[model samples]
Each structure stands twice: as C-alpha cells, then as structure tokens.
Target: MNASTTGLRRGLQTAAVGSAAAIALGFFSAGAANADTLVPLPDGSITETLVDGTVVTITRTGETANISPSMGSTPLHRNVWVSGSTKVEVSNGGSGTIQPGYIVACQLTLGGKSGTDGGMSTTWADPDGAAKQTAKTAGNLSIGPGQAVDYKILDLELADPFGAEQHRAANPYKGKGSVTWADSTLGVSGCAGYAQARSYVKVTVNTANVTGNVTLWGQPFSIG
Candidate 1:
C-alpha cells in the first residue's frame, strides 16, 4: 500500500480507539454513581408519594454506611436510604413557590429500621433558600399483657399550604435501632427528621424559568 494510504488507515484506527475510550468512560461513570444505591432492608420496604407528585421508595440495607457532608460525618448504623442514585421524572404537583419554575428534593437514609420501632430519616433539598441535607431518627412502641400498642412510624410530612412550591416538615431520617422487648418495657430509640424532599431536583441544565421538574441530574434518573 502507498505510504499515504497507510498513514490514513492508522489515523482512522486511532480515531476509532478514541471513540471507544469515550464510550467506555461514559459507562464507567454511570456505574460509579450506583455505588451509593439503597439496598432493601431485611424483609422491609415502603413506597410512597411526595406532595410534589413524585414517588419515593425506601429500603434498608442490612449493612452500615458512613455519610459525610458539610455539617459533619455520620456513620449510619444500618444502611437504608431513599435510593440516592435512583432518579425519576415527574410533573409539577403544585405551582412554583418562587414562580417561573419548580423544585426537586432527593433524599437518602443513612440508617433505617422499619415496621418495628425507632428509625432514622434524611431528606436533601434542592432549590432557593435550602440546606444541603438533614436527617433524624425517632419512634415509639408499647406492649402490655392486657393490651398492645404500636405507635405509627412517621412517614413524609408536609408543611402548611402543601405542594411542589411548599415545604416538607419531615422526611429522610437516619440512625440505627434494635428491639429490646422484655416482659415489661419495649425499649424504643431514635430521633425525628424535618426538612423536605419535595420530589424536586434541579436539572443540571435547563432554560425554562418554571422548575417543573425536581431532580438531581436534570433528566429522569432511576425509575427502573
């Protein structure tokens, strides 16, 4: 083959390799994000809707994990979360609060134990005048020979004038828990959460004024 032809072939081969590398990089990046996936608990899980028309699912990972943010570092006794990497696309549940846009709230629990007593919750907010994230754990359980009582586990709470533009009173709590059931007292342990996972996450990029979507990655993330 001519020298020119040989050189052209080499150049094409190099280009092909570069494109392949790019594609491989894209796939790897996506995989890295899943390192933080929220595993289901020991025979426990819950699916609920946020006031903002977005659905949220919770599951507990039998293991424990550490979450470090600007506030501080916390070691979640048991791994449980709202599935941080899991994303979803949703329409506006309510009108924009500030107007010309919507909001998105993503939440993950550092530690969660459910269907029992006392658990952790954590909620991360994304919008104007918001904190990075917050978590809490709280619960109550009572049993008696004559009667038994099961205090309700706190679900997501909404603020007055609830909606997409509104605020969440509680959600995404975090912490560890165990059952100390005896003939007498049932030891209940934990705190409570208060923030907001409005199901509103800002699209990494957008031109529209109204924040119709509330997501972390801008587009739909983990629905499947």
Candidate 2:
C-alpha cells in the first residue's frame, strides 16, 4: 500500500476502536444509574407514595368506642403521612354523659420527623364568649349537665405541604407517618362517668419525588 493510504487506514482503525469504547462506557453508566434508582415499596408494605395527581383514600370503618371517664384524659394514637394536602373527616357515633361542672374537649397532635413529642401540636374548639359557661352539643344530646348528649363532629380539614418538617421519620418512598387523636378531660369535675365516643377518619396524601422506603408506627387503636 502507498504510505498515505496506509496512514489513513491506521487512523480509521483507531477511530473505530475509540467509538466502540465510548459506546461501551455509555452502557455501563446507564446500567449503574438504573441500579441506583429507588424502587416502590414491596407488596403488603404499610407505607405508600401516591403518584402525582393521584389521591389515596383510606377509609376507617367500624364502631369502636374509645371510652374514658368524662373526668379523665386519654390519648388516641395512629400513624399517617403528610405530603401534599390532606382532608380529614371525623364522624361521632353514640351517646355519652357530660356531668355538670365538668369540661371535656378533643385534641389533635402532629409530630415532627421523629413522631409524637418530636413536633408541634394544634388544638381546636369553640370559644366561650361573655357567658361563664359554654355548652356544646353533637346531635340530640345536650352538653350541659342534667342531660345526655348524642352528637357527631364533622369534616375537619388539614393541609400539609412540603417545607413543613415531617412529624416522624418518613421513608422518602417506603415508610409510614404518624398521627394521634385524643379527648381532653381537663375541666370535667363530676365523678367518673362513661362517655361513648366513636370516630372514623380518612386521609389522602399528595405525591412527590420522595425516594426510598417509609413506615408508619403508633399504638394501634380500633379502626372500623
């Protein structure tokens, strides 16, 4: 072969080798990326991430009474997530007695990324105006003393967005969130009396790029 032809052939061979090496390197890089990608939780896992624009509805079914003396306090516990915004609806079922000179109220707590005692808490109730006594009723029951009350507390909505610290450590893709509900006995002065209370809550979590597994932990109460 001529000198120039030989040089050209050698250059072509070098170019082909370089191109093959580049393609191989690309394949390797892609495989590595795929391997590092996070996977969804396995079947039967408690934690779940809703797809963007997807709504996950958890309906609590049944009649479970969390009974306590109208004069004493107790904590209601559950594990839930706060991602996008969530709407919660609580329905009360049954009758209870709120004796005179006693005060009872409902309270909710939202824990930080570390669960309860790790975040902030907020309370809701009717304000007492000029009257020295405030009376609250649910259904056919009267809240003031000398009477029995039957009532339901309806549609309570809460919106949780990103940037808000998580109440409990959440798996970016696979762990559970924590939530708790309880009734207060702060001012109930009457002797111990039983108050029948039943509630059902439904929560819908928003979706995001939270990667990895997550789990929800709390004292399991009745959900029916």
Candidate 3:
C-alpha cells in the first residue's frame, strides 16, 4: 500500500476503536445512573410508662429503604420503597392501637435526638408550620421545599356506625400485637433540594383506669 493510504487506514481503525470504547463507557454510565440503592436500616425500640403505671414496649424491626432514581427523571422527584415491622407489648392487660408510618421531609430538618432542625419536634402532630398534614395512606407524597408530611402504612377500611366505609390508620389490639409492611411506596415530588425520611410508630394504650400514648422513632435516611 502507498504511504498516505496506509496512514489513513490506521487512523480510521483508531477512530473506530475510540468510538466503541466511548459507547461502552456511556452504557455503563447510564446503568449506574438508573441503578437502585438498598439501605439496611437499624432497628430501634422504646419503652414508656403510662400514667396509670402500665408499661409499654414498642419495637421496630427489619427496617429497610430501597431508594430509586427519580421517577420523573428530574432532581425534583424522589422515590423510595420502605419495609418494616412494628410490635407492641402492653402490661396490665392494657389494650392499644398501633400506628406505623413514615415522615418524609424536603429541605427541612426533623426535630428529635438525631434530627434537630431549628428546634422543631418531629411528633405525629406537627404544631410547627413547616409541613402540612396529608391523608396519603399509600406513600404517594407531594410537598415543596422545607416541608414534611406523615405517611401511614396501613389503610384499614371498615364500616362506620352509619354503614359508611371509612379508612383507619390505627389498628386496635389487645395485650400484644404487631404489624408488618412491605414495599410501601414513598414518592416525593416538587422539591428541588435534598430529601429524607424516617420511620415512626405511635401507640395509644388504654387501661381500665387511664389512657396514654407512646411513640418510637427510627433512624432517618436520605431518599435522594
């Protein structure tokens, strides 16, 4: 072959190889961008004494959060699937209702031992104007920046006294009861900042003489 022709052929081969390498790199990058993240969370438990000398123990076990890429393929959208179980034990033949759920927040910090955003408390009823409450039972949440909302995992449908169908977030129980949830969806949108979620179990116990409430908080984890 002529000198110029040989050089041209070699250059073409090099360009082809370079293009193939680039395509492979792009494919791997896309796969990594769309990959899911599995988070094994730490289990937590709490014990509280009621006003009537009744002891209550609440335990949260097998907690996990599977964070996924943005559902909308944008920074404003975050999706997560959470799984966990809550067990409650009451003393003195006390009965109670168990409420297990998650608290998802955007840009705002949760108030607690591990979370302290402007000294705000992360209780079930947020007296602070940070986040508005929602009736989203199945974990489809929508909130703006600096906002947080509660997500109940259970949606117990029952007939009311008037024969109308109603949904209850709490499950009534006797001495000992437990609830398990799997693959609960938590979809957040309309927030351009970082997002986080935490698990919570609130139990309202009633004895023959008095009634009280005990709450257990879980570790907070990032969604995006």
Best by lDDT: 3
TM-score of 1: 0.21
Worst 10 residues of 1 by lDDT: 97-106
Q: Model 3 compared with the native: what TM-score?
A: 0.79
* TM-score, every prediction: 0.21, 0.20, 0.79
Q: Can you write out model 2's per-residue Cα lDDT over 1-224, one digit (the tens) per residue?
A: 89999999999999999999999999888655532111121111132333332322222212122322221222222111111111222112111111111222222223212212321112112112111233343211222222222122222333468555432211121122223323322222221222222222223233343222122211122211
lDDT of 1: 0.28
Candidate 3 local lDDT, 112-189, one digit each (tens): 222334322454344233235664547677776666777888899999999999999999999999999999888888
Model 3 spans > 4 angstroms off: 1-28, 108-131, 135-137
Q: For residues 110-217, could you state the per-residue lDDT of candidate 1 as single tens digits?
A: 453322122111222323333222222222221111111222122334545545443332222112112111111112212122112122222221222322333331
Looking at model 3, report the run of 10 residues with the lowest lDDT sum: 111-120
**Deviating ranges (above 4 Å) for candidate 2:** 35-91, 94-224
Q: Go through the candidates in order and give each one's C-alpha lDDT.
A: 0.28, 0.27, 0.82
Error of 2 at 62 (Å): 24
Q: Comparing 2 and 3 by TM-score, which wins?
A: 3
